[model samples]
Target: MKPVSTWAAMLSLSLAMAGCVTINIYFPAAAAEKAADRIIDEVWQLKPDAATKEGAPSR
Candidate 1:
């Protein structure tokens, strides 16, 4: 029971430290294009109705 409490305390401290740091990574345009293609393919595969709705002109 004592070891469990100590481990939990240590985990909380580690998580607090992890929240202090930030990371920003910018991907290249080619990678973004590939990802967009994949997302579009999946969305169209799952939701053709949504595709038609998006294509329709708004009044």
Candidate 2:
């Protein structure tokens, strides 16, 4: 009974320590924002002012 309780305690302690680990992750916020902006621009098909282009063909 004592050995079983000790084993259980050790297992719980190991699991607790594993759960408390702090993992540091590096993220490039500026690059992510730029990429997101580019995707949004592509999705919206943003274009410059049509009137500004003197040579633009009109349909």
- Best by the TM-score measure: 2
What's model 2's TM-score? 0.58
Q: Each candidate: what lDDT?
A: 0.84, 0.83
Clashing pairs in 2: none
Q: Candidate 1: where is the Cα deviation over 4 Å?
A: 1-24, 47-59
Report the C-alpha lDDT of model 1 over 1-59, residue by residue, as the tens digit: 44568888999999999999999898999999999999998877875466568786545
Residue runs of model 2 more than 4 Å from their true location after superposition = 1-4, 46-59
lDDT of 2 by residue, 1-59 (tens): 44568888999999999999999998799999999999998978845555357677655
Question: What's the CA error at residue 41 for candidate 2, in Å?
Answer: 0.9
Whole-model lDDT, model 2:
0.83
